[model samples]
Target: MTKYCRYHRNHGHTTEECKALEEKIEELVRAGHFRRFVRKDDNSFRSHHPPRSDHRCPPCDSRHGKRLNQPANHDPQPARTNVTPVDPPLRGIINTISGGFAGGGSTSSVRKRHLRHIQSINHITHSHHRRRMPPITFTDDDFQGLDHQQDDPMVITVEIENYAVKKVLIDQGSSVDILYWATYQKLQLSDTAMVPYNEPIYGFSGEKVSTCGYIDLHIIFRDGAQTKTIPIRFLIVDAPTSYNVLLGCPSLNTLGAVVSTPHLAMKFSSPSGDILTIYGNQRLARECYMASLHPQLPILQTNHIERPPSSEIT
Candidate 1:
């Protein structure tokens, strides 16, 4: 038979009772003092402290005061506020008239670029106005050979005044209108003509390309069989590798053009008697365009929701 101690193995009490120790322990707990207690089984002895009085330490979670179902009291902290200073409203008024433009940040190179654009524009405009040449006939009356396979495109057309140009392409996708300087010289827009463009013309890599400038007199397109003519600030650029002249937004706005690439067409009309219409194969245009339509619906302006804006309708 197995022999057991004075107290049973299951109970935490030791086999040998220490009566005076038990008497003092209960008194300390009642007085809110921390106390340690130990218990063991027949196999081995292990020590552990029993929990103290009912009152919990602060920050401690318990069922008595706060309910178990109550959510934690912490709320997220607010985000830090921006503290950057903003420009004074009067700065525009002051800068607009004053000769000092970009202020301390203006670099000599940048200033020269601005001056060059101004001077070149003046030179091109002056030479174009003073030294005239027999005008080139710009006809956009439905080219017979232009028809072919095409993807869907949104088409728009309008007239830009006396621009002496057949078509105006407003590919918001293109960084800028690329023009051929040779075309301007061919127009008899002669020398003292230094190509003064210094600003980087952006391209596919989103990098600037070096080039010269020229004047395209106008834009011509079709609005449902009616011819349209629009006036524009045309740039004559040297683009030997590409098309003769490019019509960037500056030219397109002058012509009031609406673009449609996916369907491979565009629509425009001029005040002039000749109607201009074009149809193209998107495969052909891939060399020139990166279509810009987005997957999300554009937030329609309140006025433009039902119909196109007044400027567009005209």
Candidate 2:
């Protein structure tokens, strides 16, 4: 007698004895299909998976009422509001803008008001730009192709107006985005493209650097087929620097890019919620650093003088 299998509709074996049928059922169970048939406490067909931990931001100071470092069993006490509120003086109509607080009263009240304002702003921002942004994580695998032994600045290439621009330095220290005059000229943009900005920017050495003006350009950051285009206002400065452009905190914050020096890469989320990573060229970064250190000096020319050797000596 032959056993009949309902799954295979064959007489070779029963469904319980069929290896292929068993495998198919197991695969479906693992894929979360037929969940109603699965036993909750059955260890025989159970799978254990650890919970994922996604890091949002760095650990903030716990003194600011954050429960980051609080013990699991510790109970938080309510904030004391015993301080006498001091009413801030009213200001008259001022012609010029001056320093002032939006919230008046005691320091605690002011801080609470400020926090509320920040929270409301964040809520509005998130409501407008809500998306499933993949968390940016820098793991040991991100360092696979990088040279871990050397300290190199993140110098990567970007596309501006469909032109591939190189030697773009990612500088978190800089508050503003900068575009070198040389690079701007190479881009073949007209002078009229820039809006006249008279404000001079200071360098890292506190030297006042004059700017020609500023221009808003759409820059493309790409990782293979995935790309993010952002309109960045770049200040065109006529300064001698190895880097063609300096990407600063303004653009970084706008892009929400996380720069990892150890990995020598910058990662950010695209509009489609894909994580796009831009890796730095270590060789180009080193070359740029070396070029900045030893700038091209003018060649000294010696004027040839003809003299009678013996008569001139006498």
Model 2 clash pairs? none
Cα miss at 89, model 2 (Å)? 33
Q: What tens-digit string does per-residue lDDT give for candidate 1 at 1-314?
A: 22222322322222234232443444444443442332323222221334333343224245566533223554223233333444556633211111122221136677687767657866666755664322223334433224434442322223333223222234554434444565455334554444354544545544445555434354445444455555544445554322234555555544444455543544444455343445543332332233223314332211111112223332
Estimate the Cα RMSD of every predicted model relative to the unseen true structure. 22.3, 26.1
Off by over 4 Å in 2: 1-133, 144-146, 297-314
Summed backbone clashes in each candidate are 36, 0
For all candidates in order, the CA lDDT equals 0.39, 0.69
Total clashes for model 2: 0
| Lowest lDDT 10-residue stretch of candidate 1 | 299-308
Please give, for residues 176-279, the per-residue lDDT of candidate 2 as tens digits: 78888878887778989998875666655556777788899998898887889998888788877778888887788778899998889899999988788899
Clashes of 1: 36
